[model samples]
Target: MPRYSSRQELVQEMRKRARLFIGEFEEIAEQDKDTLLADVDRSPAQMIAYQLGWMKLIQQWERDEQAGLTVVTPHPDYKWNQLGPLYQSFYETYQDWTLVALMAEFEQQVAHMIDLTLSFSEEEFQQSGSRKWAGSTPANWPVWKWIHINTVAPFKSFRTKIRKWKKIKNGLERIL
Candidate 1:
């Protein structure tokens, strides 16, 4: 896990990584967007759907906690151990969506996250226990960590996955 010294740093990193992640999609052809890679089960559009789904879930958790409701990490019906099913649900939720529509929704969610991040105070961003729903296992993470894991970190990782998917589709040499 990475730590941020300030909210600006977190916001900047989130923007940079998200831009890099979303930029990968521009290089992909519309027809290839739905093609599944042999090594990965998800199509490129489905991958973006998964990321968007998680972002929405995090927002819901934050909203629920702010309203003084019990926050369920991941989801209410699903536990940490049930992530596979949860991911399947994400895929199913966006299965009918076109790539263009998914891209528009992804951009909207990222903008929403950026706005949400900007609204946090320095203390709320850095101090642990700022959000009770964040949980205490493995130490209580500050709000920034929650934002990083759900946004920046996953964007960096999923960017790599999409790049690898592109290479595999083109029968090019693997970069790694």
Candidate 2:
């Protein structure tokens, strides 16, 4: 639903939101990184891994589309409605990773996303139906929408989740 007039605006917004999102993790203690709040099913580490997984998936979609291959929206083995299992896969893939390592990998992925975005021309960036994997049923989406959903929207949403977890955890700690 959001629109960007230029690639620079899109990139800037993505970077800003991502920085704020990742900054939330820096406030959490290393030991508390895995603490699952009462209302939240995922720990900070799991959330980071999920973000990494989606970023990688988006990048892969771009690569595959550019190569003239049929692009799958979520993945070959997973459907849009099957995200729970896909998320579980993300957790399993990074299960042995420490919070610090996960964060570093996330940062690297963000950088890679930025680079990929920069490679697109303005028309390619804003053109509707630019990528077939973006879907065509209800309405065609511009490439910017795809990038925004994968980056900006999730960054903002997950930042709030992490903040909520910290608040609840800290509140519980004080109560105890």
Residues 33-145, model 1: lDDT tens digits: 77886887778988898889888987888899889899877789899889999998998898888777888899899988888888889998899888786663456888888
Model 2: residues with Cα > 4 Å off, grouped in runs: 136-138
Model 2 Cα lDDT, one tens digit per residue, 7-83? 88888998899899998988777787777878877899888988899899989998998899988768889887898
Quick one: best TM-score, which candidate? 2
| Residue 147, model 2, lDDT | 81
Model 2: how far is 91 from its true place, Å? 1.6
Instruction: Tell me each candidate's RMSD, in Å, in order.
Output: 3.0, 1.6
- Model 2, residue pairs in steric clash: none
Give the Cα error of residue 117 in candidate 1, in Å: 1.1
Clashing pairs in 1: none
